[model samples]
Target: MEPQLLHGVADSVATVVIHHPAKRNAMTAGMWRALPPLLDVLAADPGVRALVLTGEGGTFCAGADISSLQGSPDEAQRLAQRAEEALAAFPKPTLAAVRGHCVGGGAQLAAACDLRFAEEGALFGVTPAKLGLVYPAAATRRLVTLVGPATAKYLLFSGELIDTPRALRTGLVDEVLPEGELGKRVAEFTRVLVSRSQLTQAAAKEFADGRTDRDAHWADQARGSGDPAEGVTAFLQRRGPRFTWTVPGPGSA
Candidate 1:
């Protein structure tokens, strides 16, 4: 069966599932091509507060489907990079709920997400070295940002799988849960994110992702949104803040 990227939304969280059980959810070129548009749709939805990327059949993605590598190699690489950039640039919080193997491009995708929650038995690796291919510079930089240069080199040079504990220690993963608890824990965390102010989250995500220099527009947004005042009032009143700031589009308010 062909690999697929499946998506759905519930309770303000969009779940994107990589499905290819036969190849351990390996991503095909077509799957890579499909991701950016799907992410665009989800990101444009004001009701969707967050996104979760995972794999079906109890396994996360294994990497690019090697068989497809024999054809349209450049297109595949380009699409894969586009997909990764889309995920990284997504305005809302994004999480990777990982299980089993997350290697090579799969590891790259997870690294693009804001947070990673892994099952205890999950394995991670960055394997371009094993394939005699160069890892993309942008992806390499993202990996370095997540796990530092030394650790990124360790994964890139060795192409060896690391367990969840090492992943957590290296900051590759935010949390590790037992086999049956990952979903519940991720859902709980997403609920907390949903309840928070989207304006604050968006600003923080942008600044945290290496946007060191702030522009005048950022300050304008903070003042215009009124989220800070609402947050403070809600805190004093011991209630949840009703944040009504929707994502701004091209010229829409």
Candidate 2:
């Protein structure tokens, strides 16, 4: 079967499955290219309050399909960069439901999500060191932001696989579940998340996202954006805000 992104929805959560389990759900360049448009669909769909990214056949994702690494290195890097941008900037909340191996590009993909829920058996690593490949700076930044400089350095430098417990301790996985219960647990958690207000979530995501960069003008820009006004008004009235703001589309606008 052709490697494909399978889409399924459950109780307002959109699940994007990477379906190439024979290779441990390893992602190809085409699969990387496919993520952005799928994310766009999920973001625009009012019914999809949260998104789940997982892989088929127990394994979350092994990494890039190195078997197909015959392309121009520059082209591959460019495409991977674009895909990473889409995943990082996707509006609304995203959860990575992981199991088995999550290494290299697979780990990068999961790190791009807002939260990661992994089975106790899952493994995570940044394996560029092992493969003699350079990890992209943006992906490195995301990993650093999640686990801090010291932990990020250890993972990137060693290229060793860490178990689920170590991953949680390092803030790689937000939550861990027992083997068979991972799917059910992820579903329950996602449902609870979607029940909350999107406006609050969006603002929280924005604020938290900008926190890493320490943008000097973020305060004034945020206040002038009108989002805070709607937020305050909705809170005072005990009603939901009609959040009219939209993030910039993929690629330079």
Candidate number achieving the greatest lDDT relative to the actual structure: 1
Pairs of residues clashing in candidate 2: none
Check candidate 1 and list the clashing pairs: none
Ten-residue region with minimum lDDT total, candidate 1: 244-253
Model 1 lDDT tens row, 1-253: 5679998999999999999899999998789889998988898888899999999978899999978655666666777789999999888999999999999889989999999999999999999889787788999999999999999999999999999999999999999999899999999999999998888888889889888776566788879889889989999999989988767753343
Question: Per-residue lDDT for 1-253 in model 2, tens only?
Answer: 8897899887888999999978899888889889888888777777778889999978999988877656776677667678777988877888999999998888988999999999998999898788777889989999999999998999999999999999999899999999899999988888778766564576678677774553444454455567778878999999876555443343522
lDDT of 2 at 108: 88
Residue 207, candidate 1: Cα error in Å is 0.8
Cα deviation of 153 in candidate 1 (Å)? 0.5
- Candidate 1 to truth, TM: 0.96
Alpha carbon lDDT of each predicted model: 0.90, 0.83
Cα distance off (Å), candidate 1, residue 175: 0.4
